[model samples]
Structures are given as structure tokens and as C-alpha cells.
Target: MQNRSPSRRTVLTCATAVAAGAAGVVGVTAGPAVAQRRDSRLKNILARMSIEAKIGQLFVPYFYGASATSPSRLDQERNLEELGVRTVAELIAKYHIGGVIYFSGWTNNIHDPHQIAELSNGVQRASLALPTPVPSLISIDQEHGVNVRIGSGATQLPGAMALGAGRSLSDARTAARISGTELAALGIHQNFAPVADVNVNPANPIINIRSFGADPRAVGRMVAAQVTGYQRSGVVACAKHFPGHGDTGEDSHTGLPVITHTREEWERIDAPPFKAAIAAGVDSIMTAHLQVPALDPSNEPATLSPAILRGVLRDELGFDGVIVTDALNMQGVRTKYGDDRVPVLALKAGADQLLFPPDIGVAYNGVLAAVRTGEITEGRLDESVLRVLRLKDKAGLLSGSPYASRREVDRVVGARGHRLTAARIAERTTTLLVNEGGALPLRGRQRRLLVVGASPAFPTDDTRTTVPELARAFDGLGFRTTRLATGREPDSAKIDEAVAAARGRDAVVVTTDNVDAASPQRTLVSRLLATGVPVVHLAVRNPYDIAHLGDVPASLASYCWTEVELHAAARVIAGRVEPCGRLPVPVQRADDPDKVLFRSGHGLSYGTV
Candidate 1:
């Protein structure tokens, strides 16, 4: 044997070089079996595809309702035939289009998941019947919890913040697994969910309830568990708003949101959850239209920035997955770069899929022109195509898996098990912020009880479920309830007057609607506290409102103004349920707020006797 292992120095140097190269190649390569399968699939599909069909595959358009009022209405039956759905079967029959993402507005009725599934199946079946084989990548935003779109038959799980408050990774995983199982049962292979954004900004308008919590580690752990659960249930979970949209103050739906943090902060706070999700094998990553000047000096949003998506996420974070864009029609991209040009820019910027494009034809043509002009190479397109096909294959679409039946859809979407899970979460997440003199668990036969807040009416916003409905859950709980509204600070004097009127009454429950703006409502809380009335402060918004109340007898932080929280609050106040909710975010001091207020584990508990 002529020293087959070689000298120590030579071996060490070669091993180090190989390690470095392997790290670099991780996200770039498709691997041996994956590459071979991709090559074979691509060749088989491409041989039957026309130039138009190939171009169509490059553009994944948004399909709105059948009306012309909306952006694009897929004349599915016609488009399927034209795209060569009349030809072969596998995945690429007529159009090699990567995927289709369903939204609420696209359906005949937003509440009807069955109707949506029927329409979706119709399209998928058409694709299957095509002469040239092509399987469809059907996707939807089924992020159970707050951002639920498919509502009618779907389980309404607590929001991400609620899950964070539960302090259980298992809770997050179960929520995702159940949601994924339900979505899969409805023929939805992809879920644009388990938002990996680490919510660091309290002023983040859009991502508040959508984010799990402010802590990167907690968010990361939850995301990993959720992604694993979804994948295990045979649904492709996409960790979204990549490179993190957690620190922005503005909503991307309205305009471009910017994060002014340094790269170090970005990696530490914002990127950890995404890193965790990627490590946990998230099938896809959805890019946000956010401007992080420190990460990409080009001033372009992450969705259209190769620096953030290709360099940071794919390279630095080592994520080898599909990179899908948020709705291209949104103002975040449309205002900065015109609607017509965003598709080409997104593709050139390394986005594998363009979601909800305003004009599919224009986008398709633009990408084709870019490839022809050498802006986006054929190799790049192939890479994206391969990734799309691989995901479809993993989803069992490539093998012509049978569509989920209506009974199966119903069994999973709003099953008894999922609802019970939601109820359990609701029971656990209700928190009590203040209880002085032990005024809570109000004793027997209280003659009068007052409830005060905004309008005392149901929230008119379609997005929110009402609070009064939940308050009704405590109808026979040994107290007569009175509802009132403390309109403004000047109204606080009126509230004081009302409290004086109800003096010697059993208890005064002053419901405070904590708006984003800091108002003079602190005076009202102080007045109630001064009177020695058993004051119970109920915050409908941020839990930080607790810091304003000076030694109130009893206080509760509902986090949300929804009906579920309202009912849960009633039970907690009535001593029917213990306050098990931990603070998801810090409750900072009103006068001198700390960067991090109450730590993650701060929660009140009323144990069973």
C-alpha cells in the first residue's frame, strides 16, 4: 500500500477545502437523485411544450373571480385547452406554469371552502386530462390562527401571538399539522404559512397578529415545529415574508415597508426564525416586498432584490427551496416598479415564482423577452422549473394522486378535534394583568356589574369577530351587566361621573379600547382606582395598556378584541376559568418604557383548588 491516505498536512488541507466547497454548494446543487429526476422530468415535459406553453410556465398568474372587475379571471376550461391541457398527463400538460395560489376574493363566496375546492379541482382535473402530462401545484394561504382565508369549513385556530402565549411548541405544531391536513384534504398541496418573521417592531401594522411573537428564538422554535408538522402531514409549508418583514412600521399592501436595522441585527433578531424554518426543511420561502437598505443598497424590496433573496437567504442562510414572491399586484411592488415590469424584475432577481401578478400575459411575455435578451438565462429558468417540479413530485401530484373528497375535506377542515384544540388554546391564553386587594373572582350575588367600551356593538370590520357576542357567554354568572362607552379623555370625566352614579354597586368593569395612539385614558383608570371601586380593566388591543393603570383592583389583557377573547375574559373574571395566558410581548412602563419590558415567561395563574 503506497500511503493511500496521504500525508497528514495534505489530508487536512484537502478536507478543509472540501468542507468549504460543500458549504457553498449546498443550496446551489439539486443533488444526484434529485438532479437526475429533474433532468428526466424536464426533458419529457419540454419536448411536448411549445414556446408559448414554456413562457406560460414561467408566469404564475393570480386568478380572481369570473368578473372583469378583478385583475385576472382564468377561463380555466379554455386556458387549459389552449395551454395544451388537451395533450399529455403528469404535471406539464398544456402550460408548465409553476403553481396557482388561491385567495378569498377569488372565490364565489369567501366563506365557502367547498366551492373553492370544487373550482380548484375543476382546473386541476382539466390539467390532468391534457395530452402532455403536467401536474398542478395548487396553493392557498391557510395559515390557521389569525390569517385564515379559507374560513367556512376551516378551523379558526388562535393567532400566532396566542400560540406564543400558550408557551408550547407542541401547540404550534399541532395547529400547523391540523391546518395542513385540512388543506391537503381539500386538494390544496401548498400552504403559504407559518410566518417566519420575528416580530420586533410594535408599530408593525400588518404583521402583528400574523407573527408568532417578538422573540427570535421562540419564533424560530415554533416555526421549525410548525414546518415539520405541516410537511409530515403531506402539505408543503412555506415559511413566508423572507429575510423578515417583522420590523417594518408600514403595511406592504399599501406601500414599500423599510427596515433600517444593521445586518447584525437583521441576522440576530429578524433572520433566526427563517433560518430555523429552512433548517427544518420548509419546502418554500415567500419573499416580502420590504426595503432593507443595509442588506441591499439597491433600495429594491427583498422580493425583487437578488442581494437579499439569492445572496442572503439562499447563500448565507443555506436555504435550498422554492422562493415565491408575494402578490406582485400589491402597491409595494407596483408603486416602486410599474405592474408591467415587476414579473421580469422578480424573475431576474432570483424569485422562482411570481404570485398574483396583475397581468399574467404581460408578465409571461416580459420574462420570455428577458430570457431571450440574456437578462435571465435558460439555466436559471431550468433551475426554477426543476425546483417547482421537485416540489410537485414531493406533494404526490406528479403521480396523479386522487383529489380529496368533500367528506374528507369536511372531516379535516372544521373537524371536532381542531375546534377542541382552538377552545383549549382560547382557555389557556386569557391573561389577567392586575389584581389588587384580590377583587377578582367576584363573590356571590353581585347586584350590579358595569361593562364599558367602544359602541358596545359588534365590530363592523369584516376581518374581526365581535366582542359583545363573547361577553354574552357570562349571561347567568351572578351579576347584572351594564355596557358603556368612554369616548375620549374628556369622556373619562363622564366615566367618573358614571362610576359615582354606580357607587356602592357590586363592581365596575371599565373596558378600555386601547387604540394605537396613546390617549389621556390613564386619567380614567386612575379615577376608578381612587374610588376604591373594584375596577377591572379590559384591554382590547396591546397588553401594554396595563402599565397605564395605577394599582387597579383587577385588570385583564385580551390582546385581541375578538369574540373568543371576550368570552374567555368573562370566564376568567367570573372565576369560571383561571388566567393561563402568558404575556407574548412585554408590558412596558408607561413613563419609562424599557426596550424589553416583562420577560417572555411572565404570566399569571389561578390554580385549581
Candidate 2:
């Protein structure tokens, strides 16, 4: 399953000019027109501020400040208590931190709509207590699907890849708007979303299912849509993982991934979506922790590479927006430097805001020391503070108390209309990959059906393959259904149990998630296909499952196993809705690279030849 090329090495590699650009680092200087438009109010405030407050503004640390004493699983995993600070008020007042990013552990154990609103208000009120009264840029990864951090009281719209499968620009816009609308209602100003990675390599461990698609133009179109959607609703949309994280097999969370494409290839494959995002006037761009030697030969990551961040993104792409780094706590950056040193390197590399530094006190002190020693110049720090302040001003945080009312949070978060919009996107994105001999549109209510469940087939999957809910959706359609659940791949005993149950059934429905990655799931499906009953295969994760299970009479992909998506899949199965979704990524035959089972944009229509 590992799809790395040995030719692509771990060390930074690039051409002469590209390497020279890294050394020269030419984009930090602002042009005359840009300088002319600088906010006079912000400049005056910056001139008056002390170094402590200025350094604080540059760090956006994560907060584990909910009153719940019992730590959630994420809290235990991240060791949130080790950071020392407890409440938002305490952290903001002490560090005078510029902003806060909320992770689920903050309130998962005791998350009420009113409590969340109160927490957000408290954070802002603490910021208001500061000398300059700079309201924090309250941010979350409300990216709407799998990447979402706040899910309980929010609209569960399909993720970026699902929208890509639907292939409707309007749907993409709607998803973003709904996410923005809901987050703004929660008093959150920034959303780290609309993953701009092109997902060129299917073997990519992280960006898959999050990215829009493999094609550059398609990703560009969706990225622009999401940005417009979020910003139009007053939520700052942060396009992420710049230049790109699409082609690497390594997950930057655990290890540093090196993207080995040449500068020409980088521009051709990875940079287009970011270009489109910048042109669309995105509010911020988050740097990836991975290394792109083509953009910088100094062996530094994109987060700490001036050539990639300033020369390419800021100067060449002309993006004057706030440049934020991906979480500083992630091992991608942490492995190279200690908590104290990372902030200085990130700032020196042209990053405006240091996000999620593991130790806020250390990171803050590090930046302050760097400023005093002239490692980070006063003017350079001002440039970033100016951009961050401008974004806050645009969000209307500078004018008054930036707090969400409990009444508004109750009314706007997960509103009925917003839920419908999410459902519609899910319905539209249910792709029908293969339907041989017209095996779908199962009729005859009296006929019995067999439903079998398999665990998610991801090469490294932790998510469950939702079965009972899917079976219930089918049962509601009046099929005399019998449900059976098995491990990702059944033991011989379970397979025997399934085969015996399939004998009298009129049709068989198998639910799978990422079967191509798990050999056991493939074996189970192939065995069931041997049965004489018509087999309907539903792939719940990656669409590549269909290319592997080609012999199944009918195959469908719902992208993810969310309730809305499973409901939409049921409608398609029962002939209540037509199959309209196309493939976002190609279904390449692993055995035959030249033979693609299904191309991108290929899908079947109901009752069509």
C-alpha cells in the first residue's frame, strides 16, 4: 500500500535557481500600493504597543479550558494538562495571547449550546481585559465533515471530497456558507478549512477524502468556492497546507513528509488551487509542515522556509493575507526544534501567527527573546501583527464585544434549513460506480434481503463501518431484511454464517469502507460474489473500492458513512433518488496501471444507457 518512489528521497533536492531563491528570500518587502492601503489605525496601535503585547499577538495557542475535570480521550492523548494554564481567562490574561484554537477536548464531556456560547464570550471578555483590548481570533477546524472539531450542534455537511464527487460548484459554496454561518453563530471568527491539497497520489495517507480531488483545476474551483462561502458569511476561511500536501505517502503528524516535485511540477500540480484561493481573496493561508525541496533547498519545512512562504506564496502569488502555520505542536515541526525555538524559526521564515505551540509560555518567551536579540526584527513582527489586526478588524472583533448570544446559537446552529442543505449535498454525492444487468432499484417489498457489514478497509483505519443504521435504512424501505455484522474481514466461521444466510435471500447488500486497502475485506466480498444472489456493494469511504470489486453486480460509493450520506445511499438503492454523482478521483486498476476501471467524472444515471 506504500506508494513511495525510491527516487524521491528524504533530503531537500532542487534546481539552482530554486535553491538560490531560498537564500535570497525576496517577497518580505511590500509594494507601494499595498503600503498605501495599510490601516493607519492599526499602524498607530502597533507603534504604541510594548514588545510583550506585540509578541503575545503573534502566538495563537490552543486552549483546553472547559470546566470539565474529567479529560476527554483527546485531552489524555495530547496531555493538555501539562501546558499548566487552566481557563481561557487565565491563559489570555497571563500570556496576553493573540488568539485561541479550540479542540474537542475542551468541552466534549460537558458541551451544552449555552455553555459553548458562554465559553466563547469568556475568551473574548478576557481579551477585552488586555491593555490594547485586541479581541482574539477564535478559530476551529469546522471543516464540515471528517475534519470537523465541533460536531455536536453543527450541520454535518459532506467534506471537500464529497463535494468534489458531486461536481457542483453551487454545492461546494453551500457547504462552505453553512459551515461559516454556523461557526459565526458560535462567535468563532476563523475556520481552517477547504483543504486546497490536490490529492494527486492515492497513496497519500492524510489528505485523501479531505482534498477536493486529484485535478488541479477542480481543486482550484472548489477552493475558491469555499473561501467565498466562508468570507461572505463573515468567517475568515483559511486555505491550508500550502504549497501542497497531496503527493506524499508520509503523514506529517508523525514524520516530516518531503514533496519531491520539481519547481515546474510543483507549480503545475500543487500551486494552482492556492493561486485560485489567493485570487478569490481568502483571508488567511496555513503553511504545511512538510518539506518541498523544489521550493527551498535548505531542508526547512514550508512552515519555516522563507522561499516557499515569502518568495513563492507572498511575492509571486501576491497574497497579502495573514500567513498562519499548521499546528506547531505537530511532530513535523516539533521534531526539528524544541518548544522555545520553533516560534523564532516560524516567524523568521515569514509565518505571521504561530498556531498551537505545545508550550505557550516557552513559545512566547522564545519569540520575545528573538525580538530582543534582533533575530526577529521589530518591523518584521509589526508586519504580521498588522495583518492579524486587519483580519480581526474585518471580522468586527475590534468594534465591540465579540460574543455569541445563547439565543442566536440555539436558533442558528444546526437550523432545520441548514440540515436540508447538507442532506441535499449528501444525496447528490452518492456515486453509482457500477450497476451491471440493472441490479439496482430493488423492487418487490415481499422479497427478503440480506445485509452484511464489514469493518472499514483502510490500510490504517480506526473508523467503524456503520452497519445497523444502514440496515435500518434498508428495512424502512419495507424489505424483509436480516442483518449480520462481521469484522473487517470475516473469520471462516462468520463467512460460513454469511453464506448460509445468503442462500434464501432474493438479493445481498454488502457494506464496506476502503476495501481496496484491506485484503480481508476483498476476500470476503469476492467470496460473497461467488454466491448466486445478486450482490450490491456499497463503498462507504474511498471510491477506489469499486475498481477492486469489479465483479460485484452493483457498486456504489457514499464517500463517508455519515447519517445523511447513508440515508442518501438508501434512497438511491430503493429508487427514491437517482444516481447523479461522478467520481472525483480515478479508480485505477492496481494490477494494471494502463487500465483504469473508472475515470474521474464517470458515473451512471438512473434509467440511462
Candidate 3:
């Protein structure tokens, strides 16, 4: 549904002239003469804008074309123009949107980094073409390493676990810096990255590989380094999913995941990374949708809680930057409060901007209605608008040259420098979990090898190619390799066939996760071990997977099954790469069922050399 537009005369007519009077007061503020003049000019411009326009500025919604997920059946741009639509640039000119957040999955044809950059810049330019051109607060989730949306030619770095395993803050900083530079070159002014969640829950479905490690201090330290690097590269960095989304076992994407913890525990375990990010001067903070009863017993998620966003994040934590809500359409928020109330509640609860509201027209009108009804005052709108404008100014969006040249974007998007940086970070972050029985560096005479796992597959919609990439890397290193897939569960016949196939082989490599304990793959591994063949079980999901396999002659936990990690694993298994990675998290032994097996940092090495 479209917004109701008031007559031009009615909009031009002030209801109370309070905004004008306040604008005058701001205009006459005594400061250095030059500063006063600029402030007066800004105040005058703000004064001329209607409340609807101002509120519209604070509501940034996600826009997608057919090329993104599906092309728009209707011509959104033509419709918007016909509606006197305040494009994002107009919002900047009128209300000053804090920034635009880019989600890769929201687009239709973003097959690679270059396309993403092109599409984003094209949109930004179109938005800027509006009258009284204003710079857009262009943002994207280019966290690189992993969780990257711009895949194609972009350098795919290792996940956060790899960085924690590397144990090098410098490497983390370098990774962030490279990512920031690439983002900035693509006309992106902000990066929602360096997920600061302290991964205390091993069962966390979404944030496992995204977090740096289980240790709060380690996660905090690495986040701080990354923040420093991103800001240094002139891209405002955002540390996200506040109040911690890492401790929950469920994914918030599908439904509301309640985090049951006391305020004390929350303060102890979930607050460090945020504190560190704030101290490092992160420019923005994104709220999570999880329900934390201890923080706000009113049953409101942290995203819509004044006690949390205002009292805790702003007043208590001393964060003065923009407070952005997670996507309003996500089930966590939408399923509870409904879309009509999100903007009003979020803004009133202290969020400065609503990120990707489900319905922009509804959000715009709802917020405008709230302001008109005094649910949210015009002053509140002004406060958020000013913060957004200031951020735009800082991002050089207001410097009159809001768009980067296409050539400049081309030069930066997937530069060799970025790929090399990603590769270096990936190489260092690769962790080696176990090397029992000195079974690695297989004898030159031993040519038979069997590799099995779900990790090796073509990059299809359903699966990634980490395992296949590793297998190819092994082939490059001169190893004769045989591949097998154990579809979450190995077939009994297939298991027996694989066991028999490996009888005369020098070694066997089995990749599986303990989390899938009930799967047939675990049973397959046990049967293979029964053959007395030296089995090198690579725990690709979590080190805890080792607990399901009992005692094997050799085992390794690479933590994540990303392509780079698979390559690292292949090198270590073939003795081409030394095992430098240590377990960043604990591993358990199946025999000692009740006892914890490998503690954090516990991983056996074949030898230093």
C-alpha cells in the first residue's frame, strides 16, 4: 500500500511552528562565526523539511530488483518517481537516512563481487540523482573470510574460528583492513562485520564459525583489532547481534530464540565484545532479536527495549553512535509485534534507524503518524536525523562527490591485493586439531588413499565445495585420491564397501561432525576403524565430533569446512603443510563418555618440522 500524501499547501503549513522556532534557536547558536554560519545553514535546511520527510529519512528499507532474488514484476523506480518518491538521496536531503545496509541474498543476480559492486553503485547513483542531491550511507556485509555475500571473484577468507586458531591479533586486523578497503572502493561506506559474539554455546546453529572463539576475552580482543583496522580504512565498522546471539542453539532467522540467562551471566559472558567494540570506537551497533528475559522482563527483545538500547547500550555502555535494528522482517521481530508497530516501538525504544523494514510505506507513515500523535516527538526525529547526517558527513557522502567513478570501483572491488591478503589470513588461520600415531606425511611408497566426507562437493545450492577443494589441493600436491560422499549418514552397504576399499590402502580420511551423532557416518567411521586400517578422521564441523568416533589412530579437527580450511587440511594430511593449527575449542573422546577429551588448544602434532 502507498502512503497518503497531504496537499503541498497543507505540508507547507506548519501545525504549531515549533519546528521553525527550534530551528531558529539552533540557527542563532553562538560559536566560531564560520561554524555558526554552517550550522545556521544546516538548521535552515532542516527547518524547511516537513515532519513526514524527516521521519522518512530515518526509515531505510531494503530494495531488491528481479536480478537480486527475483526481478521486480512492477517497475519500482518508475512507480517511485510517479509517487513523488523521496528516493534514498531525497531522504538524505530531507530527513537524512543514517545509512543503507546491504544483504547479499536480497539481490537477484549478484553472482560475484563485481556484479554486487556494480549493482550497489548503480542504485546509489540513481538515488543520488534526485533533486538536492545527498550522499547515501551505502553499507554492505562484506565480512570477507566467511559470511561473505559477494562471492565470485572476491577472496574467501577463513572463518572466525580460523582466526582464533591463528592466535594473531595482527592477522585479524589485516583481514579487516583489507575487507574495509574493498568495501570502501565499491562505494560502500559501512561494513556490518567482525561479529563480536563470544561463542560459548557449541550447539549455536548460526554463529559457530562466525565468532572468533569461545573465550570472551579472545573474541573481544580480535573484534577490537578488526574495528581499528576497518575505521583506519575509512569504513565505519558495525559489531553486531548485540546482547549476544552466540549462546543460543537455534537460528533467529526462522523463529524467536530465547536466551535463558541471568543478568549476571549476561554481563559476564555476553557483554565483553560489545564493550571492546565500543571502546575501539565502532561507528554502529546492530541489535539482535533474541528474547533475553533477564535484561528486559517485559518480554521485549533487546532490539525494541529502551532499558536495553537506551539504558544499557547508550547510557550504561556510553555508546553514542547509531543504534541500528536488525532486519525488521525477520521472524524474531515480525512474528511478535507485527510490522505496523516496529518503527514506532523501535524508535521509541532508542533505535536510531530501522534496518530493512518489511514495508517502507507502512514504516514511513507509521513513524510519521507516531510523530504527529506525539507517540514520538519531532525532536526525537531531529535527533536521529542529525546523527545520520553527521555520519554521512563523516563517510564523505556529503562532500558533493557522493559517487565513485566506475573505473575506481573496478580498480578496487576484487583487486589482487585483497585476494592475497585473504589468502595470507586463510593460511595463518588454518588450525590443526589432532595428529595421533604420527600417521600424517604418508610414506612415499603408500599410494592408496580414500577420502570421505560431505565437505567435498560441487558448490550447489544445497552444499559448498570445501571437501572437493581440499581433494583437488591434495591432487595438486601429488596424492592419488579417491572421493566418497556419506550423505549426513553413510549407507551401511557404502560403509562396508568403503571399508573393503580401504583394506589395502595406506590410510583412510573420514570427515564428519559429532553434532550429527545419529547419522550413519559415525557408524561408518566405527566400522572402518574395526578394519585396523589407520583412519585419519577429520572433524570438519566441530572438534567435539571426535567424541563420537572413539579412539582412532589419527584425527584432526579443522573446526570449519570452508574451502580454504579444506585446502589447509589437505596440505597437513599430505605432509605438504606443517600442522600449525591448535584446537581453539575443546574436543571430547567417545571412550571416556563422561569425561571431556581434548581441552582447548589440545591438538597432537606429528613433529615441529
Candidate 4:
């Protein structure tokens, strides 16, 4: 194996490499007039495309293989059959489907970078065989920190909240650049990321740690930097869930969320980050499945509202790039419209691309029928097709060979330098919120330590736990460690069992996950604190756990459950690394009514004490 770990000098060299590569990624820049003239090729291509091809350009359907257990060699053939095509080339020749979104279910081999690159090449070859030879725009949800749709061949960075706490615009750029370069190496063209939503609502179940932080200005700046970084690395950067999904309590995956803010209120709070994203030259913006009566009086979600998608996003914001809908299969859109009607409504509502339509065949036929019956005008359809073609042209899909080599993919994806960048961000963002009685650094002669709480696991990852890795770190420090978890809130018997386990321990270290919402976990921590043992609580998920912990002598927030973050927390405990991270999001105690326990931007350094 290669030495895998790089020194600081090597990391800086990687940063400079990114800076050099960025200048060539989004290389084409011309004034509005020159840009319009450049679209003549796109227009000529559109003039040649048949009605079926034009309609196909508007739809991006998802493809998942028949089973996850299928071998890699059989996947393309199996997927073709499942997609109702005899061969890969027939997908374009027959249905003329514009693009296919790859889900993990698409193949068991989805995580292999070499395999992914080969798949991209195969798809491109199929597209090239068509009469028009227009290459497909291969895309993925490579949103890091959270929702990494690609795995095994990618670096797992700490989530958006960690980046918020890291608090460096340059770090934001470097992180995005690293993510985009790996994606491009895998022959992926678009990254649906750098979530622009300002996470103001702590109760928001979905966008919690995925968002940068609660402050609008900070979110705007960070997402703007990410947009620049991604586009400069040759991947289309999509700022999503516009105008914003930050404050809503509902998950759009299950139901259509309603945001009741007025137009002025939206401008003040929800609209700033999106505005910044557009200003940063974002290539695409994904519409939210949200209903804002203030923007559009109709009950329809933004995905189907012309007033929101066209009037607000396009006319007001002056965005001329591709407009994509959030996955149409989600209940947010599916519940309102039938399979056939969803794509038609989205296109009419100004979406340039219909992503993840439930049934590609039905959606394609429905769009073709609408255009022929005058339900959708030919001119209207052409406008979106032209925009799609322009984007494809800008991405160099029309001009250059859209194939990546396996060797390059191996060299770039999750390379040592990129891993180092992720580690540095993880190290810097682990915030220390409370140390009431000099309880951290484990300075005492206590040789026995008890570790308790939730198993360390990221919200996006379910395979491994950070507990064993964390235990080994403590073991390396010469502390005899005991690990315990009741799996749920302990009853009398379970509590007695835990108390027995804690009897001989000198100090207790508890790792918390979502304790703000998990009352049983909260109660368990309080009970442990009452034992008069020095309990040092490490919150491994949401930082709001500090609110529930309530002066537990010592508490730290990791904002993630990844190994890099866990190891960083262990180093903080062992006094090898100082805890210098500040809180990016505020914490409010349920017992206190008037004040925040720890304000946003508040962090403590060991040297300061």
C-alpha cells in the first residue's frame, strides 16, 4: 500500500494544485452578447433534433438494477432489461431518454470508481451512437458532510455544521474542490450540493447538520464559495431547495412543506443564500417542493408553481442556467400529480430538467402528447430544450470526449492529500462547549474510564461504529476503558446493570446522539452525572445535545459521527490536541427562558483557560 498519509507540506501542495486546476474548469467566460452568439450551435442542434429527442431532453429518470446482490459484469445487461431496453444503445435510440440518475440500487458496483468511470463511458458511447450524438449529462448527489450518494471511492468529510464551525472561506473552497475533482475523475458531471439552506430551526429534522449554520450571512458566504469551487473543478454545482427549506419542520420527502413567510420576510431570512448562490455563477438551481402562499397564492408546491420558479427564481433573480426539479418521485410532488402529469407541470412551470420522474416511459409519452395537443406550446418546449443544450455545451459534453480513465480515477479519488484536508476540517470543527470543573484533558490519576451512550454512527452511514476506534485511541493513552450501551433508555434493571458497570470506574465518558430529541438518552446522562463520577459528555451528532446535558461538568460537540471526528475528540480528551472549535449553531436550554446557553460563534480554547 502507498504511504496513504501526507505531511502538511504535501497538503499545501494539493491546495496549490486545486488552485491551478480551477482556472481551466469553468474556462469559458464571455459577455451576455457574446454568449448569445455562442448559442447558435445549440440552436442549430435543436433545429435538427426530432420532437421525441427534444421531449427526451426534458426528462431525467432514475435507473436501479433489479437487485443489489447482482454481480458487476451482469449489471449493465440486467439494468437494460429492467429499463425495458434490449441494449444500452436502445435506451437512446428507442425512448430517447435524456439522462439517467444513478442510485445505490442502480448496481452493486456503484461504489467502485473504476467501475463508475466505465459505466459513464458506456453511457456516453450509447449516446454517441444516436443520430444527434448529444452526450448525456451524468450526475450524482455528491453532497458531502451529509448525503454522500457515492461511497467506497470517496472521502467522507464531516457534515455542513462542521464546516460552519471550521469558519474558513478557503477551507470551504478546498473541501468543495476536493469533492468536485473526485467526482470529475469518476466521470460525474454535476454535484447537487453545498446546501444553501440556513438552518435556523433546530427542530428541522432533515436539514439540521446538513446546513452550514443558523446565520444567513454565513450560509450565503459559505455556499457561494462552494459554488465557485465546484464549478471551477468542472462539475455543475446545484444550490438546492429554493427559496429555502431551513425553517420548516416537515421533511419534503414525506409531504409538501408549507412556508408561511411573507415576501419581505423571505427576502430578509430565506432568500439571501440563494441570492448569493446565483451571484456565484451556479450552473443549476433545484426547486424546492415547498408551498409558500406569500409567493404563490395557489396551493401547489414550488415545483409546480410558475410564480415561484419563473417569476421569482428566473425573472427576479436573473438566473439563465438550467432549472431542475427536486426528485419528482418524492411524495411532495407525487401526491399532488399523477406520474404523467408531474413532468408536464414541472416543464410548464419553468423547470428545464425533470429529475427522477417515477416512470420515464409514461413521463416521456405524456410530455410528447402535451406538445402535440397544444397543452404545451412548441415554443415553450423549445425554450427549455435550448437551455439544456446550452448547459450541455457549456459542460463541454458536446465538444470533448466524455470518458475518464480508470487509472486517473484511482489516482484522484480519495487520494491521501484529499483525506488530509478532510481530517483538518474535522479537527478544527469539533467544538468544546462546556468544561465546568476542569474536567477535560483527563489530568487526574484515574486509570479506569467508562464510556457510555449511543454507538458512534453517522446519520448517512449505518455500517460501522466509532466506539471501537475511539476505545482503541483511549487504550493507546494507557487508560483502561469500559464501553457500555443500553441500546435504549435503561429501565430499573438496565440502570442497575449500568450502575454496576460504573462502580469501579474512576471517571465516565459518555457519547450522545440527538439527546435533545431523545429524552431517554437525556435522562440516562443526568442519572450518570448524579453518580458523582466525573462525566465528560461528547455529543456526536447534533450540537443541541448541550442543551439537554445542562452543565454536566464537561461537554464537547463533534457535529458528526465519522471516524476523523471521533479521533479528533479523543485527541482533545487525551490533551494531544487543544479544543479550539467554536459553536457554529446556538444552544438553548429548555429550563432557561430568556437566554441562550451558548451563543453561535462561541468556543473555548485550552490556552485561554
The best candidate in terms of TM-score: 4
Q: Using Cα atoms with residue i matched to residue i, what is each candidate's TM-score against the true structure?
A: 0.81, 0.89, 0.84, 0.89
Residues 409-478, candidate 1: write the lDDT tens digits.
Answer: 6667788988787667666777776666667777776547766553233222354333344445556565
Off by over 4 Å in 4: 1-24, 66-93, 105-109, 444-448, 456-461, 472-480, 485-497, 592-594
Q: Is candidate 3 or candidate 4 better by lDDT?
A: 4
- Badly placed stretches (over 4 Å) of model 3 are 1-49, 66-99, 456-464, 500-504, 588-595
Q: Model 3: how large is the Cα RMSD against the reference?
A: 7.4
RMSD of each: 10.6, 10.2, 7.4, 6.4
Tens-digit lDDT track of model 3 for 1-609: 111222333233212222222221111122466445544545554676567556655666655442322245453563254322424333334343435655554334355555555555554544444333344677777665446665655555666777887778898888777777666666677777889887777678878777888788888998998888887776778898898998898888778889898999888888999999998878788899888998888878888889899988999999878888888888888767767798799998988878887666667778877888899988888877766654554554543344445565567766788776665666565555555556676768656677776553422122456555666776777777777666566677888787777777777787885445577777788888888877887777666676676667677766566665677777677766566666666654555544667676765456742
Cα lDDT for residue 210, model 3?
76
| 1 or 4, greater by lDDT | 4
Give candidate 4's whole-model lDDT.
0.76
Error of 4 at 230 (Å): 0.7
| C-alpha lDDT of residue 251 in model 1 | 91
lDDT of 2 by residue, 512-572 (tens): 7666545567767877888888888998778877767657888898877766777789888
In what order do the candidates fall by TM-score, top score first? Answer: 4, 2, 3, 1
